[model samples]
Target: MILLGIVLAGAAVCVAVGIIADNTAPATLTVFGQHVPGVSSEAQVFVAGVIVAIFFVMGLAISSLALGRSMRVRQELRDLREEREESLTALELERQQLQRELARARGNQRPTTADIPVAGHRKRDQDPVSPFFDQSA
Candidate 1:
């Protein structure tokens, strides 16, 4: 693409030079009803072409910068997504490890009567109390 652009620019320069050289007739420019002195028609045309080329180059530069910025942003987003996936995987592994440890700890312990609930009795009724306190009432 760079080579193509360079070739096209060289062609345009050649064409503009040819046209300027061929048109030797004296010409004047009138702007707002005032005659501009000493500048030929060819010179005016060349200046206009140069201004257009400058704008074209500026547009290309701006577009390239925008493309670069968008590409960088895309790369950053991809990195963030990968990092998030890694974090989620690590968290899942840690959770599984904690679950295994919890299961192992529970296996190492003995079951007590307090760990089991009695039928037809609330936990508060199961507490030891003095016989004088008639809890059944």
Candidate 2:
């Protein structure tokens, strides 16, 4: 993109220089039906070219600022998603730890009806009650 901008700028300069060189006649600008002071055609073309260049630069600056803002927003969204996943993983680990503690407190017996997993809870292929505890102890 930088190279393309540079090439386009160089082309514009070449065109403006050619126009100024070829048109040397005296000229006057009129705005709102009022005749402005007369000047060489080359000077008028140069002023017009300067105005166009200024507007082009302004447009580029505005677009660059908008692009920067968009990129920042995307980065923030990605960071938030990663943070959310990490939080969920931590919560799941805490939940499993709590379930193990509850079973131990109940003397490691089979769960009662009230101890059954809720409908909203994710089903596991293994037994809900962990067998890590040794009843022979």
Candidate 3:
């Protein structure tokens, strides 16, 4: 919306300048030994040139603003992606650490025929039979 306003203002200024140039008589101005003549009442050509120049300048300004905005948005998105990656990495590291701890705790238990020894089996085992001791052949 602000860009639209700026474009409209530029066009208005161009038209006003063209009208003023049309009304004023030709006057020769010298700068750096170069003579510049005033533009006369040729409305069609002068107005067209003015309009073109205005639009060209406006387009350049708008393009610059758009490029800046796009760059900022891209930077923000890149930062968010990096943050997510770091969080996922930390979560995975914690999960792996927990898994290692669980494995270590399980190692303290003895193994049996079923791979899970009965609780306190050694306390009642004067001559504890193996799992297959009483199995019929």
lDDT of candidate 1 over 1-137, digit per residue (tens): 44444555565565445545554454644443444466577677567558647655655566666667779999999999999999999999999998889878899575689778778776866667788997676
Cα error of candidate 3 at position 39, Å: 9.4
* lDDT of each candidate versus the true structure: 0.66, 0.66, 0.64
After TM-score superposition, what is the CA distance of residue 58 in candidate 2 from its true location, in Å? Answer: 0.7
Model 1 scores a TM of 0.51
**lDDT of candidate 3 over 1-137, digit per residue (tens):** 34664766576666556545554333332333433355334565465457667776676677677778879999999999999999999999999998888878998454556655567665444557687885645
Please list the residue runs of candidate 3 whose C-alpha ends up more than 4 Å from where it truly belongs after superposition.
1-51, 104-137
Q: How many clashes does each candidate structure show, in the order listed?
A: 0, 0, 0
lDDT of 2 at 23: 48
Candidate with the greatest lDDT versus the true structure: 1
| lDDT (tens digit, per residue) of candidate 2 on 1-137 | 44445555565565555545654344644433444465446577468668657755755666666667779999999999999999999999999999999989998987677668788775554436556763544
Off by over 4 Å in 1: 1-39, 108-137
Global fold similarity of model 3 (TM-score):
0.43
RMSD, every candidate, angstroms: 9.6, 12.0, 12.2
User: Between the candidate structures 1 and 3, which one is better when assessed by lDDT?
Assistant: 1
* Cα shift from native, residue 15, model 2 (Å): 11
RMSD of 2: 12.0
